[model samples]
Target: MGHAPVMTWTVRRAGPGDVGELARINCESWQHSARGVVPDVLLDRMLPESYLNGWRRWVRLPDPDGVFVAEDEAGRLGSYCTVAEARDDDDIHADLRTGELIGVHADPLHMGTGAGRAVHDAALDHLAEQGFRYAVLWVLKDDWTTRSFYAHHGWRHDGATKDHAAGDQRVPVVRYGRFLNARKRNRPPSGFRFPAFG
Candidate 1:
């Protein structure tokens, strides 16, 4: 019996032409993942066109390093991630040179297909390449799946918390951070294994 061909993914910087699909992916991924976390009304009100316009404007700005997308050999976009300098309100414990993983999303159908990991690794590499010593990200406090994913990838929560206003509700979030160079040394605490790409 013949084995199925192994699927591979490639990560690349997003361009102007990708804004429409990126907006669709962002909207769909958010609706799937944040259905209960974010207000249903807000999620329902999200328009892909609005996100497309926003992405278009963002990509046109002076950011040479901004967003990235992961695609399979079949040219399907499976995941995307965005990185930026840490914001003052991010409550990060790292130095001012830290970078932030502002957003990451995987198409629900591609959740376990390694696309997410590829985007994440690419984002970290981009941050390190840009001379950021540390990286930080925020997750909903009750998002165990996301928290576990970050922890398994060598990130640690540093007791920082923030509440983001969503409509009339406040959603609590926690911060996770990791040293970019330390990851290169494969020194993740508790023997966490960084999976190698095929």
Candidate 2:
């Protein structure tokens, strides 16, 4: 029996042309990850079209931040992440040169394929390159899997919490942060290249 060929991923900066795919991935990932935590009504109402419009606007605007994506050898978008200057009023480290990891989602089917890691690593590297001294991200309080994932990647909860309204319920989220250069501040690994953005 012949073994299947392993798939590799390419990481790049997301552009306007990728809005549709990015929105699709975002919507689907939310559906998969928020099934029980988020209210059913809210999840059901989340259409790709709505997200597409938001992504379109973001891509059209001038953002000092960056959106990065990971694609498989077959040219399918497997995951995406976004990083930007911390703009949250609740951020405790607002005084520091901090960046916020706004979002990072992987296709449910691609969860274990390193797509998430590829985009996450690139996002951190990009933030460091942008001269951010620290980084922060929010995750569902009860989402153990994702929490552990971020923890393993060197993030730690800083005892911060926020409530996100979903229907009649206010879902709690925890904040995680780390030094942007906590890990090595070198170039990305071999075979992966950061995209050039204006």
Candidate 3:
């Protein structure tokens, strides 16, 4: 009359070992979902090995306070996120809102399993804990699925645009944002935490 236990996943700082899995998720998710949104050339360039190397370099970047990964019961990474306060410092996006949800990527197979949402929640929770009052990110105007994905999570339309690079192609992107309460932000996980804001 015994039952099997439930398998719980944990979200924590990403380590060097997660690079391979993270790259695979990044490559597969982008390649499969962003077909018409991103340029074909860019997809071609996101080669598996290239992505692995890229992640290796990324994990070494001077990000003493960014990047996180989610691991399931098997201790395998399922998704990851990169949160930054100074978006301008990075060339990935144009606007570079002071408080921004820099980047979030999830495994294609884990799309609807809440891994993406968990990654995003962790980022925002971290930022809000860091005292950020607002956050922004650019989404392709023509990428309805991606847009809906953001909207479904409560991002308000900002009615803005920015030049996005899809390989060599430049396209205008729509902006969306969310205003953190600044008074009651989500709490970060224990040990590693950011100062609370009001």
- The top-ranked prediction according to TM-score is 2
- What is the overall TM-score of model 1 with all chains considered together? 0.84
Better of 1 and 2 by TM-score: 2
Task: Give the poorly placed runs of model 1, Cα more than 4 Å off.
Answer: 1-6, 62-64, 89-96, 184-198
Candidate 1 weakest lDDT stretch, 10 residues: 189-198
Q: Whole-model Cα lDDT per candidate?
A: 0.77, 0.79, 0.68
Most lDDT-accurate candidate? 2
lDDT of 3 at 66: 63
RMSD of each: 6.4, 7.5, 7.8
lDDT of 3 by residue, 139-159 (tens): 778878778878777775666
What TM-score quantifies how close candidate 3 is to the native fold?
A: 0.76
Q: Which stretches of candidate 2 lie over 4 Å from their true place?
A: 1-6, 61-63, 92-95, 184-198
Model 2 gets an lDDT of 0.79
lDDT of 2 by residue, 1-198 (tens): 443333588999888889989988998898888888888788888788888878877666445588899998788999999888887756636344678898789888787778888999998898888888677899989878788878878887878789977667899999887776555543333554331111
Candidate 2: deviation at residue 3, Å? 16
Question: In model 1, what is the error at residue 82, expressed in angstroms?
Answer: 0.2
